[model samples]
Target chain A: MEGLSIKQRFQETLKSVYFPFVAIVVSLLFGSVVILATSSTSPLTAYGHMLKGAFGSIAAFDSTLIKAIPLIFTALSFSLARRSGIINLGAEGQFMMGALAATAVGVATPNLPAIIHLPATLLAGFLGGALFGLITGVLKVKFGASELIITIMLNYIAKELISYFVNGPLMDSASSSYPQSAPMEPSARLYKFIPGLNVHTGLLIALAFIFLYYFFLWKTTAGFDMRVVGFNPSAGAYAGMSIGRSTILALFLAGGLAGLGGCIEIIAVQGRLMMTSFAVPYGFTGIAVALLGNLNPLGVLFSGILFGGLSAGALRMEVMTRDVSSSVAVVIQALIILFIAGRQMFAFKRRYRYRPSSEKRKGKTVVDDATEDESPTVQATAGEGE
Target chain B: MNEVVSFFSTTIRLAAPTLLAALGIVFSERAGIVNIGTEGMMLVGALAGVIGSYVTGSAWLGMLIAVFVTVLFSAIFAYFTVVVKADQTVIGTGMNLLASGLTITVNRALFGASTSPPEIDSFGIVAIPGLSSIPIIGPIFFNHHIIVYLTFILVPIAQFVMFRTNIGLKVRSVGENPKACDTVGIRVGLTRFLSILYSGVLAGMAGSFISMGMVSFFTEGMIAGGGFIALAAVVFGNYTPRGVMLSSLVFGASNSLMYRLQALATNIPSQFLLMIPYVITIISLCIVSRKSNKPLGSGKPYIKE
Candidate 1:
């Protein structure tokens, strides 16, 4: 709760940036070494294709952003729940439910204009996902069931339910075909921002949600309650916060974001619910996005893009390289999660910053600075500190 | 009547792998560390055992190798979760993902991309000579593969070890109150590490049973969600070997019922019939939550003061 001046705040931010930044570089370095050992080809050439697939061409970059859009929402959903100290592993299920709901809405409302139809579909998706997550949250709070297991089990249940619906009630009657819903009306889809590009305004909406997430988490009373409950429910209760309410709210809010992701995925990219195969597993990948982004909304925005880039590139690499499949990116993602989970990055920071020589001096400086606040003293090197 | 008996007997055989895996999970989780990676561990073991048996042309050797390699990785897994203080949940999830990726990658490289490996008609039935006269009881229970028989024997042995042995008491105590046990001179972390290693052996055995005993070969994600089902059984059994065995039997029965119901196809679609197992699981889980008997500090690892 201690508020610092602009310069000191900048210094604190700089201190915190090292862990995530270094983690990325180190993980990529390891990926490079792995590439060299396995491929027996220059790792650079393969990485060049990775770069080309993500950013070398306008088409590639746009597709990357398109893939990134839903992830930003799911990651933001994860971050919101995480800040309050609950795990929302159900986001993938929620996201899928959202897609199912939106597809139903999109197909059912073909006569409506784009403006009316699009938002309605999204709202349905959001509500579906949010409600799905809320069921687990409510169960955990009311009945002491574990949300982690419930969500995992619910994922299979949800998938089967959707398959049943699509193959039966919602099956497109035009053709005897796969278990996929009818395509959305062109009017129901997101309008592409650039003339011929696949990238649409969904990215803009996702970014907007990211900003809202940041504001809600960092600058609101309810956000404070969520964070307090996250820190410790007993303490939060002592502080007059309802832990149950916060947990429920956090899950639904997170689920709402994921629902939006699902809506965007269907309406913008696939224009239909893409049948899940082992080939592309984007749902689980959101956890990596949330971790790589360090569970920050804006950070998730970029990390989502990074993963999307990997997703874009790795698919190509599978064909272009032949020996290695796109699933190799999975190893990299796992390594990132593995390294980050050890708390080693944070502990390493504590070790360096609390070095014996630095600690005594820094401790003295902290006391001195606290006392100096009484005098309103001005100091030089503020720019360097910032 | 014969159809019903055969159906149930087949269910027992089908559930043998899961029953064994659930028992494995019971050992590990009772020691207080969650082993959600049981699925991945099973996959790796299944692959390694199949490959080993294929190359060596001896199913027993392959099964042994699977157990060793899986136990080795479990040690690595133990080191990270136990020694490094890595979060078990994340590590477990990573294990599943890693097994899936590596299995396919290695399978392709070795066999040039065949999904099914060569069948080893290696594992044989353990037909007890005197027990055969017992009719349905003997056929349903005693007459089975060597591993299945071993599994049946081991469940009782596991129950005895967990309830009767001093080491078992210490393991359970470490899970419940590691601090108190540590104060009294028990090595909490080491106990957990050993328990996890024990789990690895049983889980490996289960996987090898599938590859060499259940099916003739291995396929990607063949373990599929069975490992997770074992996980549910562990929790549902309240961490007792007997309880775990019973739950695994129930799961096995439900799965068998689904297949039978699918075959009947009187009115319901096969898809709907296919959904029966998961639907039953969800309903059972909901009921279980309303009345869970989870041990205190079930997921918390002991941190010695």
Candidate 2:
């Protein structure tokens, strides 16, 4: 890339950029068809309302930023694991566990000073999700169980566990009818940073972690080892790196990130953990964000905001056009992932490229290029052979 | 005594969907494609079944439509994973999300976001005269929705085809080594595509059984994690038809027992009871996955050199 001239570099960037742009455009087009088929309102009108709701006002932009916070966290979680060759599908469950832990600490240890209590609650949330994630990692390492199936199973188990807590021990006694936890105390809550805006310090944490994610993955030795394992476990193992350790560490950190997102969401946005708190599915949406961003940290930040806008706008679209469901946003999100995953479908031409001298080196570079250029899903599946 | 009969009967009835879906998983997995999208296919199938029945006024027609739509859905999945050579698991995950969103959208559009499910024609028990009358054994097995019997009958047929037939041999060989299969003049891509489609057919049927056979209305998220459980059954069954059948029955019994225990007002919390199948799936996966009979080339997309 550094060897390329300015024009060639611009062309290369265009090549990388065009696919996701096309995917987003195609997905929105598909979304419009659904709107047209289902609602009496014109698709254009619905989209206009959606766009207005997402960015037309300070309040709308605030909501978009707020929604993007959790997504950024989950996307980081996914990107971390993908970098380590583990598919952390349990982020949803981990996020729920994080919220549960935050609630447990937030409600139980009330009246403490903000400094101690707030950080304590946040730490609890991280540990909650981290331990949950470690369960999958341990099972995979020790038992050879596929993380894919285990993570999914853990998600269902985590939901049940949440229900058990909310209905049984953690049920808010003041409101016996509602299966929800007691609200967190002032000290444990994530107070809004801007005076009138609804956004919280969680946005700062999300931004900080985005930088950390880039730094850790690209700069640190451990991160380099994990990426090597992800690229080719056999080669990494041959190079004396422990695959088991990388898998466990990656999943643990991934879970913690998601958990922290859940924690912040509870303390800042929701105020209390309710049975229906997971209705939006932040974890799955994160996968779309991560993929659309091409698994780059900065890219995830932008895509996260974009998805946040989509959801924020979708709510208004549903209201303005009562016939249309907000779930159309989900359809668009899913389509983006599908298109990104099956990107070869969008390729119309084979561009001539420069080749390295050694055939063996060329093969390795191709795999690396595939990892960077295409969705991480391709590399994850290819690495499964190890 | 009657309670015992009812319990076993409920077990079989509950097992039918998982059994059907697991049968599908067996076919797809045997052909070297990991179908994590079985859940999505089943979801679409359930909704399509209801829509078809609502329109045609026949449960059988609903079942046919369910199969048709699900096949079309899986065909897209096949096209991506087979022709486009995308990652199967990732695409499957996308398929699940798409299924969830699309079902909710379509269901809301046609039925108007009402909380109450739309009433539609559904399958009913067809008691086989002589067999259904066999006192103790008859009620447990003989009397069920037609799909239930069809589901059980397909077990042996699937077993026969998977183990005995030429097509099954080709499918297994292709999964084991696609390049070798290609070398032997087998059309690897076509075989895999068909195997995935066959899985789609059975998964659709399984889903139809859920909406049209077990109940008379469509509910959002009705298939729940039934598709994933079926995926587990495929693994626990060691990728064989008979194994998958037994695994499905085990999972079905657990589900049936959970509901029964909850109804009986047992001391155990309903949440804990509800978690039994998922927990059991994880445990069973751990126990069975040790031998690891997973297809050598299952998750990897085949690229002919």
What would the TM-score be for candidate 2 when compared with the true structure? 0.95
Candidate 1 retains true contacts at a fraction of 0.28
Model 1 lDDT tens row, A57-159: 9998988898788778888877787777676667777888888888889888777988888889989888988988888788777866666666766676667
Interface RMSD of each: 11.3, 5.9
lDDT by residue (B1-305, candidate 1, tens digit) is 66687677777887788888888778777777788788888988898898889888888999899999889868867766776555576667667776776677666656656455565546877777888558788777777887887787789999999889998888788776666777888887888889888888888988888878877688877886777778877766767889888877888888888878877767776666666665555555665665544545455533332
Model 2 chain B: ten consecutive residues of lowest lDDT: B296-305
TM-score to true structure, per model: 0.88, 0.95
- The digit string of per-residue lDDT tens for model 2 on B1-305 reads 98788888998999889999999889889888989999999999999999999999999999999999999999989988887777687789899999999999999989878777767899989999999999989999998988889889999999899889999899898888887898889988899999999999999999988999888888878887999999999999999989988998899889888888988998999999999989989988888877767787777666654
Every candidate's DockQ is 0.24, 0.50
Highest-scoring model, TM-score: 2
> On residues A324-348, what C-alpha lDDT tens digit does candidate 2 reach at each position?
8999999999999898887766765
Alpha carbon lDDT of each predicted model: 0.73, 0.86
Off by over 4 Å in 1: A1-11, A25-44, A277-279, A349-386, B112-126, B130-133, B289-295
